[model samples]
Target: MTITIDGLSIKKKEDFYANIKTELNVPEYFGNNLDALYDILTEHPDRLQIKFLHYDRMCAQLGVPFCQKLLKVLQDADILTIINQH
Candidate 1:
């Protein structure tokens, strides 16, 4: 499955988690944090392709440090991921 996240739509950390949770259809018990995100992405049984649109905008909105951390988690995940700045 493919999940696309529009960086422009993410104004805060919560927006990022919410978008991921909703798109991934994670359990209601899912924790809205970076660790939880990594757990879910790594443990997912099916192959997934995650697309990040306007990545620079996302970094600007979430701050480079946080976005770097988030990117680390995503990059470490077993699933496929694509990041786009345009």
Candidate 2:
């Protein structure tokens, strides 16, 4: 499955997590945190392709440090294909 997230729409951390939870159809019990995201994506049953548009803008909004952490989690997830478009 493929999911596209527009970085411009993400105003805060919660927006990003909300987008992931909704798009990925994670259970209600899912924790909205980087560790939980990594656990879920790594164990996901289906191959997932996640595309981030305006990645640079997201970094500008969320700060480079946080985006770097988020990117690390996504990169470490074996079952996911992450694409970033600036």
Candidate 3:
């Protein structure tokens, strides 16, 4: 089953993005495979720390490894995560 970052069905994604954007000082991008995209978020130490804190504090967040897991299962993964999203 493919999942989307927005598909998490939380109170609101705007809240999540707000925190991540504030924490990293960068705008967060939304995509179907949020798990895979996590790497881009955590590639840097400062960014990773910010993201981890956001996960523990504001919401139960997932990281990049899970994204890789999902990426493997997806056939249209590129379209859903990379091309179609941007």
Candidate 4:
């Protein structure tokens, strides 16, 4: 299933990670960190379609490094594609 995250609305790192945890149904043991997020996405059993809306806004809020990390995670996962809408 495809999951869309409203990147524009996410202004805080805490909120962004929290939303990821909820939307991805990450386990309780899941660490709320970029590394953990990467692990979850890479190991996810189901085919995931991740779409980021208003990606520019997200980048502006989260900074380039965070966005870069996310992109790398998605790239490594292979099963998911990032459809970033400008």
Candidate 5:
């Protein structure tokens, strides 16, 4: 799957952060700060499937439409495809 920002998929920040961490065999990103996470995302926009457990809830509280920023699927041949807004 693909995340699009203005048809570019750049606005989905949280999703990208999670994808890279997971792909790199690092621990799942867990923090209370979205701004910090957003900053991290700015560094890598190619990765998909990031952790946004807190951001989702906050978006719900703020009446913001939080789309599926992070997603992962095991396709054929053990392929792990992480999709984020990009």
Candidate 6:
């Protein structure tokens, strides 16, 4: 299934992870951090198609460093993450 993240609603790093965790149905044991995110994305059994809607807002809200980290994790993970600028 394709999971869409509404970037405009994410105001902080916490929100970013929380949104992902909720939408992706991430496990309770999940660490809710970038490292954990990377691990989960790489290890999860399901093939996830992640779509980031209004991605520019996310970058603006979370800042470039956080955005870079998130994107890097997604890029390196063995899953496809699409940035939907619209």
Instruction: Give the Cα lDDT of each candidate.
Output: 0.89, 0.85, 0.37, 0.82, 0.36, 0.85
- What global local distance difference test value does model 1 have? 0.89
Model 4 stretches with alpha carbons more than 4 Å out: none
Q: What is the per-residue lDDT of model 3 for residues 23-54, given as tens digits with 9 covering 90 to 100?
A: 44553454434453354444533312111222
Give the poorly placed runs of model 5, Cα more than 4 Å off: 1-30, 47-86
**Location of the lowest summed lDDT over 10 successive residues in candidate 5:** 70-79
CA RMSD of each candidate after superposition: 1.1, 1.6, 12.4, 1.5, 12.1, 1.2
Instruction: Kindly list the per-residue Cα lDDT of model 1 for residues 1-76, writing each as its tens digit.
Output: 9999999999999999899889989999899888999999888678888899998999999999998888788778
lDDT, residue 79, model 5: 27
Model 5 TM-score is 0.24
The clash count for each model shown is 0, 0, 2, 0, 6, 0
Task: Give the true-structure RMSD of model 6.
Answer: 1.2
| TM-score of each prediction | 0.91, 0.88, 0.31, 0.87, 0.24, 0.89
Query: Which of 2 and 4 is the better model by lDDT?
Result: 2
lDDT of 4: 0.82
As for lDDT, the candidate ahead, 1 or 2, is 1
Residue 2 CA displacement from its true place in model 4, Å: 0.8
Task: Name the best candidate (by TM-score).
Answer: 1
- Candidate order (TM-score): 1, 6, 2, 4, 3, 5
lDDT of 5 by residue, 30-71 (tens): 442344444444444454433333444434433343332222
User: What's the distance in Å from true for residue 85, model 4?
Assistant: 3.6
lDDT of 2 by residue, 1-86 (tens): 98988998998888998999999888898897899999889886688888889888888888999988987887788545555666
Off by over 4 Å in 1: none
What is the per-residue lDDT of model 4 for residues 1-86, given as tens digits with 9 covering 90 to 100?
Answer: 88888887789788788888888888989887878987898775788888888888888899989888888877787746665666
Provide the lDDT at 7 for model 1: 94
TM match of model 1 to true structure: 0.91
Q: Candidate 2: deviation at residue 84, Å?
A: 4.7
Winner by TM-score between candidate 4 and candidate 3: 4
Cα deviation of 78 in candidate 4 (Å)? 1.1
Give the worst 10-residue stretch by lDDT in candidate 4. 77-86
